[model samples]
Target: MSGGGAGASRSDARRNRALVLQAARSAFAEGGLVVTLEEIARRAGVGAGTVHRHFPSKERLFAAAVTDRIRLFADTAQDLSDVTEPGEVFFRFFASVARLATENRAVGEALETPELSAAGGAAGAGREFVAAFEVLLRRAQEAGAVRGDVVIEDVRTLLVGCLAMERRRVAAGDTTGVPGRMTALARDALRPGRTVTELPSAPRRRNSVECGVCGAPVAVARTGRPARYCGGACRQKAHRARRARAQGRNADAASAGRQRP
Candidate 1:
């Protein structure tokens, strides 16, 4: 009947919208805004019209992806709140959040770009995450798993610092990773009578370099930190070309020396 047809259409619409969002999240995570809408449609196995109908523009799709991630974290926190191991759950949740934040390139891209705004739902999701986290913190404290003096604000700062340390390590080319260590350090501080690894010294600053191709100036951070090369992908391509040319010149020079001998 016509009534059943209308209901089926509504169900299909919801299904298509979910598909588009999933495709967008995966695509943006991999390639940021560089991934094309056509590619997302193909990934979702849906037509272009379905994607366009749900998200009229690529930016909107990106924003929606951000919103979806926020919701995911919030939902995860809510789910963990019910687990019986309240003491262990807090640290598990904390460590997982840190790991996810590192891999979440879309969120980083959104923060780096001024024009990319998150959808309205992101704010609400953030609030829900905070509330859920507070419950976890309280339960952990009640169970004597966490230090009584530690507050949610302290935990938030620790999480932020953990991410900052990770970026510094990456810039320094130390690939052993910082998050696990960061989580352990935080746990040592938060847990009752727990002693863990020593707190390491600050990360060393990398020396600022010329473009290594164009010899252009790189801007330093306002806090006196060394700056990475701007226009990175293009700069890297140019640097590789120069290296290739230099290698070719060295090979010819060796052949010439052999001929002279």
Candidate 2:
């Protein structure tokens, strides 16, 4: 009877542990690491005491989450090893990860945790990601698809920049055109020297003004290039101006009573 009781208790503990982990994963994916422990417990249909018994600390729970993601990312990379175009695979992998990180602040913060950074298994996956990236970079360099001067570190920096930009966009609640613009910037940054052309002239603006539509700073027009409007607002303004001029002419004629006819 004692043996059977002990076995049942152990089985219950194992089931609770699995339930907590599943709940943690969902919470982190939805609300990030900052999501409350109480929330996790509630979501898991467990109590705070149960959560503490399972994870002990927030750091431990966060570490577990990161480890889960690292393993998943590694498995994905391994599955793509046979891809003939390594560079494309490399860019796609990081780009997708960056997008996810942008959407989840908790995962992003967990990535910066020193404990997670120092973990041997986690560090190994990072090294593997870099190694795979290098393989693709080398192939692109050899094929003259990417600039010869570009290195693996440059690609890493680009990924970081992409993530930062995406985070900023999410914070500002302005996601329009960000992905497409980032993709274009990445292509421009990595393309071979021959594919890039020197601009015939610097983009000209008329005056410095805040663009009403996008809220970006706009430059005034120059000699050859007339500054119209910064974005859609400028185009609309120009159309309105033309209509106003035509209306004024009609009004004057009506006031003159058709030349006293």
Candidate 3:
């Protein structure tokens, strides 16, 4: 009888915890991070003490929610890995995540915030998510369905940026089809044979942007110091060009001096 009672109690605890998590996710989505434990408990139909028992603080609770969502996404991606159509599976999962993030704006915001993202097992889950995502990306790349130049980080950035833009559209009262359009554009960008879209595009950067030597788009460093050249190769090339010009000018000056003498 005691064993059965213990089992039942554990089950109840698990159910209560899940309920609290679900309620907290909804509350955060609607009210941002300011939603109180009491409000979450009320929504979950549990007492505040129960919420506290499961999650010691609001940050922990939010962290748990973020990690839980990430794990679910990772699991889903793992399940889709065996599917024959790698490209389809990849884009479908991408679209699904964008839609999920769009619906749960709080999660999206949390993901964007570095401090919040690093809290409460979210980082661990992120590593796992990346591992799973890399599998899908690898399969697609091997199958020639996705461009070889793209990496897992690129996919993550693209999806997060899409969701962030969608959130901005909602905030600006232009929410219609933002998720869908952004996702479609992401899909198009990822397709094989398409020109790889560079990260931190023109809109996201400023300063003496274009590389003077290589003519490639130069990325503005986040730090105050901006990049002058695209890379080491360009810098070396420019150095050589300057040295050649200096030698030519010296030769011309010496020739003029000799003629005058």
Candidate 4:
């Protein structure tokens, strides 16, 4: 072959490979593992033969796609390396993972696969991600922000559970408040204060009254000075009620005094 022809062929091959990878990423993201190579090739402006040349099998392609995504996520963590707050970085990383997993069923399925798990059995990116989490967890505990009992393993378990619960809620079409509730629950669970246990018994109600104006449930302050009013609005309403009652009592007294006279 001529020198120019050989160089052109090599350039074309590199372009084809890049195109295939880009198309594979988009297709896997949009259609999951069932995405067709023919469709990927079409999207890449190439032939099915080109895709097969780059990735011999669907398994190989899927693995490549997942590796690419993991590298992207790791790069994101690297970007946050300058962040001084370890807990914030840690939760941010998990939040990204959760969002990615929720969007990609293939990624979720791959995570659950025993083969992939065994591939990272002792050491790999999975172990590294766990290590990164440990750094954050230890920092948070030292800062007295997170509970000292919360270990890396606990964080891992919670992350897995959060993903599962979020997926379940999405599938059930109950995604309205899932993110806020999940975040609140996670924060409470990781907080350094007293551990709150969920018992089988019904939740204890506060022995307080509801404000008539705003309908807010008002509990006695820990200082033990007040009864039911919580804030300015409720306090103002209660004050008005008291004034009306006193005026009524004064009027009745005046009427009785006049009758006696």
Best by lDDT: 3
lDDT of 2 at 208: 52
Which residue pairs of candidate 3 clash? Answer: none
* Candidate 3 lowest-lDDT run of ten: 198-207
Indicate which candidate wins on TM-score.
3
What is the per-residue lDDT of model 2 for residues 88-206, given as tens digits with 9 covering 90 to 100?
66557666666666565655554444354335455666566567666666555444456544556666667667766666666777747556356446656676554565323323356
- For all candidates in order, the CA lDDT equals 0.72, 0.65, 0.78, 0.65
C-alpha RMSD of candidate 3? 11.8
The per-residue C-alpha lDDT of model 4 at residue 234 equals: 49
lDDT of 3 by residue, 23-83 (tens): 9888988776778999999999999999999999998888777777877877898898888
Clashing pairs in 1: none
How far does residue 123 in candidate 2 sit from its true spot (Å)?
4.4
User: TM-scores for all candidates?
Assistant: 0.52, 0.61, 0.62, 0.60
Relative to the true structure, candidate 1 has a C-alpha RMSD (angstroms) of 20.9
lDDT of 4 at 38: 89
Candidate 2 collision pairs: 33-106, 205-220, 205-221, 206-220, 206-221, 207-220
Name the regions of candidate 1 deviating beyond 4 angstroms. 1-19, 31-53, 56-59, 82-84, 107-120, 175-179, 192-261
Off by over 4 Å in 3: 1-19, 45-50, 114-124, 175-179, 196-261
Models sorted by TM-score, best on top: 3, 2, 4, 1
Q: Mind giving the per-residue lDDT tens digits that candidate 4 earns over 1-261? A: 699999999999999998887887778877777888888899999989988988788767766666655545555665665567866666666676776766776565455441432232212554555555565665555445665445566666676676677777776788476463564466567765756863232233667565443333566567855655446644675678699999999999999999994
